[model samples]
Target: MRTAICDMLGIELPLLAFSHCRDVVAAVTNAGGFGVLGAVTHTPEQLEHELAWIDEQVGGKPYGVDIIVPEKYEGQGEALSLDDLAARIPPEHHAFVDRLLREHGIDTTDRAELAGRGMNISDRIGERLLDVVFRHPVKLVANALGVPPRYMIDRARAEGVSVAALVGAKEHALRQVEAGVDILVAQGTEAGGHCGEVTTMVLVPEVVEAVKDVREVPVLAAGGIVTGRQMAAAIALGAAGAWTGSVWLTTEEAETAPYTVRKMVAATSRDTVRSRGRTGKPSRQLASAWTRAWDGPDSPGTLPLPLQSLVSEPALRHLDTLAEKGDRGAQELATYWVGQGVGLMNRVRPAKDVVYEIAEDFAEAAERLTGAIGD
Candidate 1:
């Protein structure tokens, strides 16, 4: 627990739990680990309200925020709203989605009404989220998709808030370090959302070696890292901590869609597949009919970032609802972004209990390693 990440975040444990649920965030923080709230989906006003609620619950424990500001996304600077993006989605793609849904015996009626109701990815929106975060007492801010924007880096530095960024490769980590990120989340392809095809064991040390001297930023090994021994391995390879997301989805307080959580609990490491059906980027999700469609040869290629997300958002929402109703095909296509670590997550536990479990595993692993050296 005396790792650099613990020192940097002012937490007793270096385990970082990322969740969209306020209860999960507060519980992890109060349990002596850092909890980072995913802020990409929340509007600025909603984030402000959620952060305020978290502040009241955690009683001043340190926490962080994560936003998805993809360095290269559709409508990057166009100032497009969700409606604008929805309009840009080609009619061909829409037709294809409709055909697929109906062919699979799923409903498509709600897709039209929900078309443009979600968050629109843009530099402006990300900056707005940053402004809301800076107004509060956040300890850290992370860019989930790419290097922290220069403006974000400048703002966080000015406010003394540490900035972290996720990278899927060694080169990406170097880019983040050069851009002034305070921490490197070396995420592997096995990660759930918008990831590249590199396993954690290979990616972590590669990133550590790439940035250790050029920048002394702490590296957190992520992707398929589910157990304390895995976290220990990352530390032994020079990482400062572990960045985890999927393991927290099953936590009692997680805000993951209910049906998706049920599927996650029953999933195996092999149950996931990487496809561009969700966010227009290759993200790992539970293998389902949805991913299978994109992976199939007869399917049309995926659209770019926001465009693809726009086209699929309604379908995904409907799938979840229908899947919960025992619709077999909907359930077959019902999945969410989660890492390969699903196999290790068997039961639902409290967020606080998860924090303790990680700490206990880390301690036990360290003790065993030390004893082995003595032996």
Candidate 2:
């Protein structure tokens, strides 16, 4: 816990939990760890409200916000409307979704009853969310997918907020450093959500060595890091801290869909697969009927980022509704982006308990390593 990251974050421990749920964020921060809110899915207005509520709950504890601005996606400076983006999704994809829904006995006729009926919006909305977080007391702002855009980096620097970038490769970490990112998140394939082929055990040291003399910025080990032992290992390998995500999904405060949380509890490390079916980029999620369809040779290849997002997002929303109503096939098809760490999460616990457990475990692990020296 006496690492550079703990000093930078002004906390006793260096466990950084990335979560979407406000309760989890508050709990982790209160337990002397950093809780980062994943804000890519929320609108600016909603994000502002969530941050304000977290501010009140954590009583001025430091936290972070994460956003997604992929280097390549469907709507790049074209200024496409939400309808335009929606239309780009091919009719065949829609038919495929409809067929899946019906095969699972989900009602397609009643669009009004859809779970996320009114939530669809434009990609430009993310900029507004970024602005809102900057106005608050957030200590860090992270770009989840790529190098920090110049505008975002400039704006955060102007506001005196630290900017972090998540990267799957050492090359990407170098690019982020060149772009003036204050921190590099070396995320490996074992991570949930978007990731690259390198394992955390390999990628962390590689990224650290790659950027060692460039700027002295911190490197947090990410991807498939779920326990105190894992955190200790990352620190031993030159990581300043452990950047985590999937562990939060099983927290009591998590907003994870009830059934999805159940699935995570029951899952093994091999239960997840990396596929482009969800976010266009390769993200690890539970292997299910939907993933099988996209990976099948007879099916059309998956589309690019936002285009693929367009198809997957609506279908997931619909699946949630069907899943709640006892549609077993739809339930079986239902999946969310999570890492192989799901196997390690056995029960729902409070986020603070999670933080303390990591700290305690990290101490024991470190002590054991020291004892092995037999000095």
TM-scores, each model vs. reference: 0.96, 0.96
Off by over 4 Å in 2: 112-124
Model 2, 276-342: lDDT tens digits are: 8887778899999888888777566777776777777777866765777777987888998889888
Candidate 2 weakest ten by summed lDDT = 113-122
Model 2, TM vs. native: 0.96
- For TM-score, the strongest prediction is 1
Error of 2 at 156 (Å): 1.0
- The Cα local distance difference test for each model comes to 0.85, 0.84
Clash list (residue pairs), candidate 1: none
**Model 1 lDDT per residue over 128-195, tens place:** 99889998889999886777678999999999999999999888888888989999899998887778
Off by over 4 Å in 1: 110-119
